[model samples]
Target: MLSTSLRVAILIGIIVYYFILIMLLRQKRLTLKYTLLWLFSGLMMLILSVFPQLLNGITRLLGIQLQSNALFAILFFCTMIILMSLTSIISKQNEAIKQLVQYTALLEKRVREIESCGD
Candidate 1:
């Protein structure tokens, strides 16, 4: 069980985090698709903080020995998921960039050939 003070602190921190995410979204620094994961994370944390019993139940269901350990495990899992999503996005963007570069080179070569013919 978390102390009242600790729970309050966590709640406050989550609120601040939500505000920051919203601010970034409003500024166009983060797109809605990417923000959804973070928002969902914040919502989960909010639910856990509000209902400590839920965390306890989850910990027991996962066969975790300690609540703290459970929290760490969950955090690590979420981090891994987010990292994988980012890696996939980066790979796709890289492939698109490569294709764009290749097309640009071909176009440039054609332009050069036309210039030589006109000369």
Candidate 2:
């Protein structure tokens, strides 16, 4: 059982997390999807920190026992890392598409110039 002071501190931390998320969204620095991930992550942490009992029932139902939160934390970190890798992959693809568009435009211009010279 967490002390009342500790519970209040967790609440404050969650509020701060949402504050940062809102600021990023307002500043156009975060997309809607990313903003939602931030919100969900904050909420998940808030719940896990404040009411870990919720997981107790889940563990009971699943017939698994764990004493530490480290595994869950590690899973969350892995998910974040995967998301980062996916974002990088998408960025590289976008760069490739942009380069292709530029090269195609240059080729079209060169072809036009050649046709004009031929006439």
Candidate 3:
């Protein structure tokens, strides 16, 4: 069971997080696609904080012994999923960079050949 003050604190934290996220988005520091996951996480936390009973029910359903442990488990899972997503994005970007580098080299070689032929 969470104390009233603790729940209030969590709610406040979520609000602050959302505010910061929005500011970053507005400033173009964060992309919409990446921000979606963070926004979802914040919303979930806000909901859980507001309705502690829902969290308790979920923990019970999952057979988790403690609500805090359940919360940690959920957060860990979300972190793992986010990490995997980022890894995938990075892998794709790496391939694209490699392709761009190869194309640039080929273009440079063609340009040099043309210049030599002209001379």
Candidate 4:
């Protein structure tokens, strides 16, 4: 078992690294708003990862002591749902970019033809 101090230090390290990752995404010199979104997401993930017990904190507060196993199952389902949503969004973006690329290529080919004919 790790000492309490060590555990706290590790948690702090993880939080710092997660925040750094969000900052790196904004290294593209984009606005800070986008960076904040990433940072918030990171914080959410850290909360779920470090102290998953907080997920069930509500049950105890409500005076119903549910089994921890059930809490774990619920958390797992929540994580899966979030991941699926992300995947769906990514797929839609990919399809949109693919269509844009095809349109650009077709326009470029037409431009090339017009230039050749003008020669």
* lDDT (Cα, tens digit) per residue for candidate 3, span 1-119: 76788788878888899999999999999999977878887788787777777778778898987776776677677778888888998999999999999999999999999999998
lDDT of 1 by residue, 65-94 (tens): 766576657767777888888898899999
Per-residue lDDT value at 71 in model 2: 29
| Whole-model lDDT per candidate | 0.83, 0.71, 0.84, 0.62
The TM-scores, one per candidate, come to 0.88, 0.58, 0.90, 0.49
The candidates, ranked best first by lDDT, are: 3, 1, 2, 4
Count clashing residue pairs per candidate. Answer: 0, 0, 0, 0
Root-mean-square deviation (CA) per prediction: 1.6, 4.5, 1.4, 5.6
Candidate 3, poorest ten consecutive residues by summed lDDT: 66-75
Best to worst by TM-score, what's the order? 3, 1, 2, 4
Judged by whole-model lDDT over C-alpha atoms, candidate 1 comes out at 0.83
Model 2 Cα shift for residue 45 (angstroms): 2.1
The C-alpha stretches of model 3 lying farther than 4 A from their native spots are: none
Q: Which stretches of candidate 4 lie over 4 Å from their true place?
A: 1-66
Shift in Å, residue 108, candidate 4: 1.5
TM-score, cand. 2: 0.58
Candidate 3 — which pairs collide? none
Tell me the lDDT of candidate 2. 0.71
| Model 4: per-residue Cα lDDT over 4-117, one tens digit each | 564476468667976677567657554453345455555654564466566566565655455344444554665666577668778998999999999999999999999999
